[model samples]
Target: MAFYLVTGGAGFIGSHIVEKLVRRKEKVRILDNFSTGKRENIAPFLEKIELIEGDIRDSGTVTKAVKGVDYILHQAALPSVPRSIKDPVTTNEVNVLGTLNILMAAKELGVKKVVYASSSSVYGETPQLPKMEDMQPSPLSPYALSKL
Candidate 1:
């Protein structure tokens, strides 16, 4: 069975991904700070998986969690735009730096693949028709910049 390390697995989107993974019979581990993610989101599968309550900013914690995992679904980030604007430092720490930490851990652990969830706000307010991956990026908020 492939092991999946899901960061931010207690948050809105992460929990759903984790639930689906659990149902597929995959060995799953969750890494969450619980800053905005709720315990209730992950309560349904508490007994079927491994839980690591820690922030992604802490290298030791993230590294330990990523160890032996074959795949990574990095979902840990400060999601709210207003929240990021209110606290850019924390937002950058959790979003950008935390992502770097996970990437490094994945490299060290020789993980097969690392998947990231990036938003489509990079194009800003331009009246562009189709949003393509190669388009120029325009970040309006710290949240958008972090996701970039």
Candidate 2:
């Protein structure tokens, strides 16, 4: 079975991903700090996967989490515009630096793929009704900028 690592696997989206992977009988591993993620989200399949409680900002923890993993589904982030405006440093550290850490670890470990979950807020205040990837990103808040 292909091993999969889902960062922030205890969060809403991440938990759903984990459930799908588990239902497919894939070998799944979860890395979550639980700062914003809730335990109940993954409670249904808690026994089916390996859970690592740690922050992505810590390289050591990230390395440990990525070791021996084949694919990485990166979903960890501090989401909020007002909160990021209040504390941009923490947002950058978690969203940007934490992502860097995951990439570095994935590279060193020879992981096959890394799927990043970015926010639509990166589009900022585009006048267009529908946001397309072709459009240039106009991040307004620190949270959006960090995701970009």
Strongest candidate by lDDT: 2
For model 2 the TM-score comes to 0.97
Residue pairs whose backbone atoms clash in candidate 2 = none
The alpha-carbon deviation from the true structure for residue 145 of candidate 1, after best TM-score superposition, in angstroms, is 0.6
Candidate 1, residue 98: lDDT:
94
What is the per-residue lDDT of model 2 for residues 19-124, given as tens digits with 9 covering 90 to 100? 9999999999999999989999999999999999999999999999999999999999998899999999999999999999999999999999999998889998
Which candidate has the top score in TM-score?
2
lDDT, candidate 1, residue 1? 93
Worst lDDT run of 10 residues, candidate 2, spans: 126-135
> Using Cα atoms with residue i matched to residue i, what is each candidate's TM-score against the true structure?
0.93, 0.97
Q: Cα RMSD for candidate 1?
A: 1.4
